[model samples]
Target chain A: MDKETTIYDIAKELSISPTTVSRGLNDHPAVNKKTRQRIYEAATLMGYRSNTFASSLRKQRTNTIGVIVPMLNSNFQSSVLAGMERVANEAGYNLIISQSLETVQKEIANAKTMFDNRVDGLLVSIAYDTENVDHFEPFFSRGIPLLFYDRVPEHKKCTSIVIDNIQAAYKATAHLIEQGCRNLVHISGSLKVNLYQERLKGFKYALMDNNISFSDACVISTNLSVEAGISAAQQILQMDPMPDGIFVSNDTCAVSCLKTLSQAGISIPNDVAIVGFNNDPITRIVEPNLTSINYPGEEMGEMAVRSLINYLDGASDVAITNTITLRSELVVRASSTRKGEAS
Target chain B: MDKETTIYDIAKELSISPTTVSRGLNDHPAVNKKTRQRIYEAATLMGYRSNTFASSLRKQRTNTIGVIVPMLNSNFQSSVLAGMERVANEAGYNLIISQSLETVQKEIANAKTMFDNRVDGLLVSIAYDTENVDHFEPFFSRGIPLLFYDRVPEHKKCTSIVIDNIQAAYKATAHLIEQGCRNLVHISGSLKVNLYQERLKGFKYALMDNNISFSDACVISTNLSVEAGISAAQQILQMDPMPDGIFVSNDTCAVSCLKTLSQAGISIPNDVAIVGFNNDPITRIVEPNLTSINYPGEEMGEMAVRSLINYLDGASDVAITNTITLRSELVVRASSTRKGEAS
Candidate 1:
């Protein structure tokens, strides 16, 4: 019920014209410093705030970026969001965030909302069932800068920021081989996602490089959830000959599988080596200290925003850069380190 | 750059007046259903998204809520955000979120930005060192419908959604005492936060009720991080007679302490019993599953947004209802179960 303070009110209070008040507030060279100080003091006393909405309409920029993630509760996504918030806030841009909840329908709806809201730019990690990029066609046709991170689509117009998942997964698998694990199993997510598909490629490539036979049975496609880990462990328990090495797509699932396997009387590293992606805190907390790929979630998030902001500000043209890949490395731990193993 | 498609473009494309297109788009009864369909088709063809800025200026509403949390990377905060997002999306409201990074200065700056952006309402979980509510006074004065969850401030105008921390802590401490623990230690966070202060009170009250002498020496104030847990364990080890029961304020710290103590040759439940708050997933993964309080972070988040939105929509008067307490319970596990104890 209270009215918003406007330049007109400040002008009336200071006995100056509204034009003079606006110029003074905007720090125009036409306005003297002494008058500007008096105007600022009056404006503060009256609780005057510049109307961002009206100004945004005139400038055709909202100074806000929209971020769409598959889900927000995951450790990796949250870390990425933290990084985005840090960078965006420092750049004086607000982030309007939404979750697709891993559903393509919801992803489409979220995209529509973000587009209608007129965000200056958008950063997205597509949903699990996002079969196509048709939903984002409006952004592309309108020439609104769009960037994808982590789970990206193969779009020539949009730049993608991601870790080299194929390389990361290869390192994880190769480390298991070095630990004397011959019979290997890879716990993968939905291969429909490019990242998961690339990881699967990495797994097969590693097996081929090591002269190990590759079969479809060696890869178990799962949602990569905690419960999925337990279920995967049960499935492994029923295998003709249990796997000597396991590489999971994520830390949560890997840790869960390790615990379930340990509970089932399987010894870690000695009998089976395990490697997980994402160097989450739980990797260290889990017994034997899980060997994991340091995914650099925060850095990826920072880079995505920085690239998009730079492109928007014309400081850099991210459009020409197809993909920005951050470095990822395997962190050797007891989980994948066997003593007296074959060279 | 491509220009935005306006109602005029749709009207011109459809060979109709702009007024007819606008009314059809708004679904005015004066416009026939056939005309509305034609307007929708033309709008889609032209990519005519509703100008939210200009419309919001007329309605004095942005349909966006601002949320400020201490940090975005924490498990609990992420879960809370997921809940908020689900509810807000269903209600057709957007969430512009930011993190204070546990600094009051950042919190103040975030609030100012939110105010300038004209979010319809605000939900806040205060930072570690936020001692006063002065930063949020503008929202309070503007009748903008502000609510706080978890680490809330003591404000009359704002309704807070939180679990009863004192009761939850009392339950945890009482569970430890019932397991035949006389020497008890409580690891807490900064007392500046009301939630932490209340937990300390509960710990002391539980000791008093059990006829055990309470001492300030029995309490350890920490940042409650994983590293802090290790430091607390070292501090406990140095005590002349180590405590028999330990209740940590959160799962991350408690699990860390439990692991450190176990590595130091202390047998859990037999040598010392431990209880943690916020039954995080790590509680189950720890060697001996940790006993913890189920804090219901998602429920808290949902409740906070529901209350704020209800008040904003005139469905409820949240201001009259000062505090909304959700249920929190002790989840007993292997960490605190002493076999054949005195009880």
Candidate 2:
């Protein structure tokens, strides 16, 4: 790499003080317009870059946000990242994102990286088996705004943004019951994940409310991959009394299970009514158009960044706001709607 | 924010020279093991963070790789990013990523930000309408390793990692023809992108080889979005003589078009054989299962970063290799197998 041009060099070339060159570079009103224009032209001609890293070090704020996600390939996580990137970029902040690949060890490494980088704030969606969040104490002690979004840990200091997973799950279960499903099955993610655990609670509560009692065999815990969905479907097929309703915690898994059952000659919404979370694009393309919960991934992403930025700008105190819940609703589609009066 | 502890503070507390403190932190041979262990303990107790910012400025290398993509919400892009993150993180380099959002303006802004941040190298996948390469002049002038992948610009100084799109497209088209299709329609992304243009060339060449003269009517230039797929399907339905084959540049659009056509009572393969690019997970869930080209997105990402890092480490010269093409294969499935024996 070539040695970069400095403000002092530009000042020397223009026969002016270095302070004047710095002021002109910053577009300070104290520097005359003509002098600022001359400095800009010189900077461009000389390939001079006003180093954001050095200036950020001096100012004690990098104006960059660090985001650690469980995975980058998921529909909901990517959507959230897209929205966060939009808001952060619009606010003149760069986002440094890393995927933990669903490992708490990797999450710890990523948190340490963000701390070493001196990011203004940090946003995280914990890994699947992240039992403790002590790795984030450095950021907390340094008074850097730290916030969590989906799949959050139970932390007092961090503000968490999430949809009402319990309510959404309850609505999905209630709808399946309304569709005349007597025996229902739930395909859940890891019980360690707060969201999935809450959804399980909702599922059990809904069954109790509907005067139905189910055994452990009715619920299958999975990593929610497509292959897992296939295996879950195979397990359901082996049940003496097949499940009439299925609620999956993710769209990819639900679609996979639905396809597997359909391939085995089961009529959707007749033999089985299914509901999934995260209204991913796959829901519409699948046969019978899957019913799903409209998890606002984009909104949740934007809100996370907006909150962090607000706290950074002193416009709001994110510390006082312990938990932030975004509204989510159930979307009823043909896959879960059994009683149709018109058709 | 609380005042960050520096090595100088540790030195003062340990009653040691600043040089000894720095040497101990680096685990120098001169600074014995016991001293290093004590230094580490003190550093941990005082929350002393190594100043990567100042050291990076002195070294003129940030250990950060900047990446610019057109979007962050796509399956292929996310997979590519995942691969890039894995490689970069393993190599002790951080990736600073930004999205162009399919616009030249945002790309230019992102480029400037990367330049100002003094990233060690840059990886870019150009936007839809980025006709000029002047915005990236700083990287070129400064001897920063610049690599482009997937959607790239025609720049001699930059190394581009991509699959052979022309061959992939030719295979898709020839497969459709072999499935007994006479009239064909292609759903393509913006031609401003080099990959899409090369695919178009392949499509044209395939038609000519099959003794079919093509026209503009045979191509549907679209953003390849779901809505565009629906509109394209409407256009195909209105043809006086419908096309017997369809090729879409992306799986998302292809699946959407297939679903729309199926909903309109068009029997796939028998009526119109379809082939799509990028064998995303969605390809398998669609009713007939999609026929697609397996583009090596993960490999492409790893190759881009590997090339940049090799150049940085003086292990290889990337500028000498202008283009590195990865292998892609055709995945023929139910969607394009009309005369098949159900195998």
Predicted structure with the largest DockQ when compared to the true one: 1
Candidate 1 CAPRI assessment class: high
Q: Report the C-alpha displacement of residue B277, candidate 1, in angstroms.
A: 0.8
lDDT of 2 at A197: 95
Writing each residue's lDDT as its tens digit, candidate 1 over B11-59 gives 8888889999999989999999999998998887778898787888889
In angstroms, the error of model 2 at A34 is 3.7
Off by over 4 Å in 2: A12-17, A341-343, B8-20, B341-343
Fnat scores for every prediction: 0.87, 0.78
Q: Candidate 1: list runs displaced more than 4 Å.
A: A29-35, A340-343, B340-343
C-alpha DockQ for predicted model 1: 0.86
How close is every model to the real structure, measured as TM-score?
Answer: 0.97, 0.96
Angstrom error of the Cα, residue B126, model 1: value is 1.0
Interface RMSD list for the candidates: 0.8, 1.1
Q: Tell me the deviation in Å of residue A125 in model 2.
A: 0.6
lDDT of 1 at B187: 99
**What TM-score would candidate 2 get against the native?**
0.96
Estimate, for each residue in A75-186, the C-alpha lDDT of model 1 and write its tens digit. 8999999999999999999999999999999999999999999998999999999878989988888889999999999876778988898898998899898778899999
